[model samples]
Target: MKRFINKWWRGRIAKLDLCPLPKALAPLENGRVLIFAPHQDDETIGCGGTLALLRKNGCEVKAVFVTDGGGAGGLPEGTVAIRKKEAAAALAVLGVDDLVFLDEPDGSFRNTLGFEQKIMAILDQFQPDWLFMPSVLDYHRDHVAIGQALYACWRRWQGTARAFFYEIWSPLPATWVVDISSVAELKRSALSRYELPLAHCDYLSASMGLAAYRGLYLSCNGQSGLAEAFVEAENNGIWSGISERMLALRIYFEKLLKR
Candidate 1:
């Protein structure tokens, strides 16, 4: 069985493009990390492996679910409660208990001044060394809006958190990748708690596939492991990064308007 699994993984690895290896994240000794998820399951989907590693290395980690997730899965009346419960269970499995559910409405996340203030408040309170958020290029409107709002808040507050963007509905051009091979099963266990999402889309398989692809990249770089990928940037570069993205968006929309 083990040999068969190895053969299959190697076969998958063989087809992947071997890009320059992503920088490996050093384990935190006593650091603080924060994650902003547009919805409940994104935190687990995008960075569960890193979260597990952080906990294992004694890093303080907290997650903020920006939306109540009530607008998804066609069960509005009970969706929020169900998803939140699931998220709590999932995070608990990762040894993460400090969760903050912002309870904002899903699908209509705003990038307003008030929203920025709310995000800034959390930044003020946590002041994490590392902050992770959904990538701005994510196809989901809520994900994109939350990412923009968080970046705006960081600009205002000039918070000290080093920014990293995680992928979900879109893949980031990752500058760093953390080998989560050791904690692969832990990530699976955490994600399995999202019963509703898993029922709709086999997120477990999709997410694992991405991780496996990243692992192949790592292997090509001489590391035999699975990985979670991210676009890492220092605080100084965040505003510029946001500006570049906004400019491109504006150009695209302007062209659409001309049409």
Candidate 2:
């Protein structure tokens, strides 16, 4: 029954119209992009293709792993080190050279002053124009904690950065979608770097299908694929719900202006 369902879904996804890439929304040349991942593999799963696109378009991208992801069951000890290596490999595949690992305890992440301080310090130093983090509605405890902490920090920053939430274990009602059809293979290759996750294939395949489904919904080519759906929140003067394609286009144009 599940196989039948999967087949049906895949067929439906293949029939949808392709969404064309839109103009860049904000300038990203002088701007920095910060992606906050709750675990090592998430950076690849959520934004791998988008990161590649950003680099190709000349945007500086940075990623911060909120936890060491040592708690993924079924590993003999030293899983954290193993996963960190996997993350590094994955980031390299996505063309991300600037990566930071917070090494917070796997299952024990909290919305505490210490964590906030660490995040705030990074934000202050990087001064990113766009910030990406896990969605508030994710099923993982660590993801939610990071989202809450980031939200508080964003409020304190007062619209200095445009923030968007990406998905991990939960489905986000995305207000913006990035057409990632062009980099689907890059995303898959990046995800394959994670070897500790016994069920990594299932996770990766489901995410790919979801991205295809979203691409169809956005009228993008079904085979081209999409990545990185974001829910935007209105903070201070900056508003959410702007198209992700438009946002990328804006960043591209902004980079051109800087050059």
Candidate with maximal lDDT: 1
Error of 1 at 203 (Å): 0.8
**Candidate number of the best TM-score:** 1
* TM-score, cand. 2: 0.76
lDDT of 2 by residue, 153-177 (tens): 8768744887878877767767677
Give all candidates' CA lDDT scores. Answer: 0.84, 0.75
Clashes of each: 0, 18
For candidate 2, give the lDDT of residue 184: 82
- Cα lDDT for residue 158, candidate 1: 63
lDDT: worst 10-residue window of model 1: 246-255
